[model samples]
Target: MSSSFEFTSENQDRFSQILSRYPYKRAAMLPTLHLAHQQNGYISPEVEQYVAGLLEVSLVDVREILTFYTLFFQRPMGRHHIRLCKSISCWIRKADRIEEYLVERLGVASGEITKNGNFSWEAVPDCLGACELAPMMQLDKDYHGPLTPDKVDQILEVVSDSDSKV
Candidate 1:
């Protein structure tokens, strides 16, 4: 394997163990994809190709898994992810309105990257396991809920400040 492309013996072993968990290797697709994404900040074609080769599967097989998962970033993303939930409970509490407020207030719409590369906004149309914390969004993997435009501004400040350290 090329220097940049090598999957270490340990990683390969772990992957093998993960595959063994399932009766079929194909059933282990999500775990395999999650491993690829965890190693890298986001899913890249190179990772997909490597995993495909390791599993003796086609590249399309790998690509399909990456594309199917919303958490998997098909392209590189900013340091922080702003996922505004639009699920039913959140919607009743103004999740969509908060989304609108953020777009108007923060000047970035869902699925768009900011000019500063510090943020990426997306509208998540499902429960984030915290319907009680409706009108919420996750920033930098941290959940902030029952939101208002002001709270989003606070989160943006915090995320931007933290990004400089990384």
Candidate 2:
């Protein structure tokens, strides 16, 4: 139910720095959205409005950029975001079965958040740029590869355990 979103003081400084790099305010859209996402976790409608106001652009303009980019998250995506590669290389490596395992193990369909609010996942149809690590997934910011159900279990276990410690 929490609603307020703004850059922290440090991020406000960073935002100022970001603005300085662009010749025009509108040119700063991507980096500004990235800053907002880093600080707020996701880009909500309020954020679109806020950014639009900041850059002196229309809300439609901000939204168009947001929707066009796959990396920008439009909703809360839990503490961990898992991107499973379903590209040709990964699919050939039995990534389909791995996706099935994730659905079964997480008790949620792809693109759904886990009930516990700790994880959300999506199957990416495009390459994750680690073809050598076929059957790979990007968990948060790290890529784990050559996955089997066992490796997936271990990865989830490690992340879950770390979450508990924090």
Candidate 3:
């Protein structure tokens, strides 16, 4: 299959550097896929094929890796993706209420993007490793936590404003 995606020359250089750290090309699969995801924003079918060819692995191998990792987004996401930790620590802290607030405030369900395309959110099943920050959620790269409805509102305001400026 023809892929619309190709790494920029800089990323190709980074990919080569990553490969050098592994004894076998297949050992570099995760980082290579991360680079592709960073470049393409999600793991497309074409990206799976491209990486498989690059790593000399089968397409099924790549697909399996993608499925196993929640961090690898398989479809397009809004510019800001929110991952709310729903692990035991978070759940006890009333993360469900935070999730409800997000759905209501954003006017979209979990796993769905808002109509303006600025945000998408999902409740993840695993610990985000921040038990101290229970009821936490990740917005793009940053983690915000001990969340209350008011805190969530402030975050959305900041993000929405920045998105509008963009």
Candidate 4:
């Protein structure tokens, strides 16, 4: 993919609105990055440059923010980003088995995308704040928990079907 990036007109408008909320343009960095990520699935080096130019910050400044936050992606990711919590609570509930099942079923290791680019999985170090649903995963925006292989299969099937429609 090309490294060039330009914010869409709608995003430009949103960007301006976001900047208006901040006393300094630099203060708008996070939300501006969000808009870039929404427009381009991940933040590439070119996106960083584009963002720095817009905010009048150095490229290194943009890179620092992107690297410091787990929310940002430096490379392309699949349509579905699966974040499985591996916190103490999740571990006590056997999140490992869930991770293994997901790896085996998806045929992709953690931090890697599926061959077809439909999904990507990652094991998160922090609590997903769903201790009650220990052994939980955040698929895109939805939270599912206490998963079994069967439930996983069902979820994947549903996600696949929905992805196809889009």
| Top candidate when judged by TM-score against the true structure | 4
**Across residues 28-76, which tens digit of lDDT does each residue of candidate 4 receive?**
9999999999899999889998999999999899988988988888999
User: In candidate 2, what are the lDDT values of residues 110-166, reduced to their tens digit?
Assistant: 899999999999999999999999999999889999999999999999999999999
TM-score of 1: 0.76
| Tens digits of per-residue lDDT for model 1, 20-52 | 899877788788777777667577777777777
In angstroms, the error of model 3 at 82 is 0.6
Off by over 4 Å in 4: 1-3
**Is candidate 2 or 4 superior in TM-score?**
4
Q: Looking at model 2, report the run of 10 residues with the lowest lDDT sum.
A: 1-10
The candidate, 1 or 3, that scores higher on TM-score is 3
List clashing residue pairs in candidate 2.
Answer: none
- Candidate 1 vs. truth: CA RMSD? 3.4
* Model 2 misplaced stretches (Cα beyond 4 Å): 1-4
- lDDT for residue 60 in candidate 1, whole number 0-100: 86
Number of clashes found in candidate 3: 0
> Scored by Cα lDDT, where does model 1 land?
0.78
**What TM-score against the true fold does each predicted structure earn?**
0.76, 0.91, 0.91, 0.92
User: Which candidate would rank higher by lDDT, 1 or 2?
Assistant: 2
